[model samples]
Target: MQLTVAPIPFFWSKDTWSAFYEEIAETSVDRVVLGELVCSKRLPFFQDQIPGAIERLIAAGKDVALTSLALITLKRERKLTADLVEMGLEVEINDLSVLSYLPKGTNFSVGPLVNVYNEGTLRWLASLGATRICLPPELPLASVEILAKEAEALGVTIEVWGHGRLPLAISGRCYHARLHGRTKDNCQFACEDDPDGLDVATLDGQPFLTMNGVQTLSDSYATTVHQIDQLRAAGVTALRLSPQSQGFADLCHQYRALVEGQCSSEAVLNAITGQTPEIRFSDGFLTGDRGVAMSTPPIAART
Candidate 1:
């Protein structure tokens, strides 16, 4: 399997976002989906930089796609969605409303935030000219296997959410803004302080989730080190890796090595933990268990 970098979910400065994509252009990732996916307000800070980033990525032989806002509600937002088609790049629809805006017969993609829980939904999306789809992180392995088969028969490629904090939900209410005693309009970009998202915890202070403006995410980074073989065996074509605050380029190569059999699971786990020792890792969503659960083969764990 190969890698497709998901759009940046957290709020970051223009320089940081630009530099991150510049570095990504040189990585082994096969494709990238980039844009303001969470909040439209955050777009102006870095929207101008997108063309340059996309140009560089394409110049380096990477397939690039623009993403629709995960929650498009307002009139201006609708205009933005409608305008995405005019950019002349593949558009990955996170919200179903985008389907209305895409020109007929345009071959687009679908992001994980959209629900594709069954073969019927997958088939419907395939009928709508969707060429690629990154399945939601919460899908079980059985579902993935079934969907992969359906995608192959329908001439569509299926990608899995291979790594990164699980994006649990997106809301019209900004949790960051509410936490700081403000409304969505008055959020003042509170999410900017947490580049990787602010950690949310239980009353006893156990890490539970993360809040990135309107998006709720898992505190643990989800990795597929132990499940890659099974996924490949099931005919999965690609793995989507979400962008993090740091060590992502190195993380990309490590995943590539793991897929190519050049590195052991132990080496990958070690490399990942060594880079960001504090972040938790999980793989349970694919295992038919609670989303946060983690397990490994004895050989993989001991290696």
Candidate 2:
């Protein structure tokens, strides 16, 4: 299976962001999707750097695509979506409103944020020139298998959420700004402090969701190591790995090793925990359980 790195979801400084893609360029990843997938206000800081990053990734032999923002509300956001076409790289449509901006018959990819739940939705997107689709992380194995079959018939590549925190939802309001007691517009990029995301906790002190700028994410890092064989058998062609701030290039190598049967899932899990020992993991969404539930006991328990 091919490994694809998803766009960075957190707001990182321009230097950190540029360095992350530079690291990605030297990895075993087959494709890399770049560009801001979150708030529009943060784009100006790193907008000029995208062309350079794209050139470097291409020079390193990686297929690259740009991502549309997950939520588009304002006229400026709409203009940002429209300008993605001018970049000449494939646009991974995270928001459906992006469709209004693309010309008819323009080939694009759909990001996991879009609700592509059934065969009908899959078929419709294919009809609209969608060449690739990363299925929503919450889909069960059965639904993925069914959709994979349909996608095969339509000649569209089907991908699954492979690794990273589950992006549960996106909002018009910035949670980071609100947490700092400021309005979204007036907020001074508070999310830049947490490169991964700010972890949320329940009233009783249990770990809960995570808050990025306007996105709510699952507390667990969802890994497909346990389900890779099943996904491959079901015709899934690629795994979309989300960018994390620490040891991500190593994470990409571990995933490549696992996909190639050079390592065990437990080994991969150990490598992950070795980097960030406090991290929790889950694959329950693939089995049709509560998304936070883990299907297996922790192979490498957190310290």
lDDT of each: 0.92, 0.92
The residue ranges of model 1 lying beyond 4 angstroms of the native Cα positions read: 298-303
Question: Which lDDT tens digits does candidate 1 get at residues 33-106?
Answer: 99999999999999999999999999999999999999989999999988897899999999999999888898
On the 0 to 100 scale, the lDDT of residue 286 in model 1 is 93
Q: Alpha carbon lDDT of residue 54, candidate 2?
A: 98
lDDT of 2 by residue, 1-303 (tens): 999999999998999989998899999999999998988999999999999999999999999999999999999998988899777899999999999999998999999999999999999999999999999998999999999999999999999999999999998899999999998998899999998899999999898899998999988999988888889999999999998898899999999998998888888999999999988998889974778877753344212
Please list the Cα RMSD from the true structure of every candidate, rounded to 1 decimal place. Answer: 1.1, 2.6
Measured by TM-score, how close is model 2 to the native structure? 0.97
TM-score against native, each model:
0.98, 0.97
lDDT of 1: 0.92
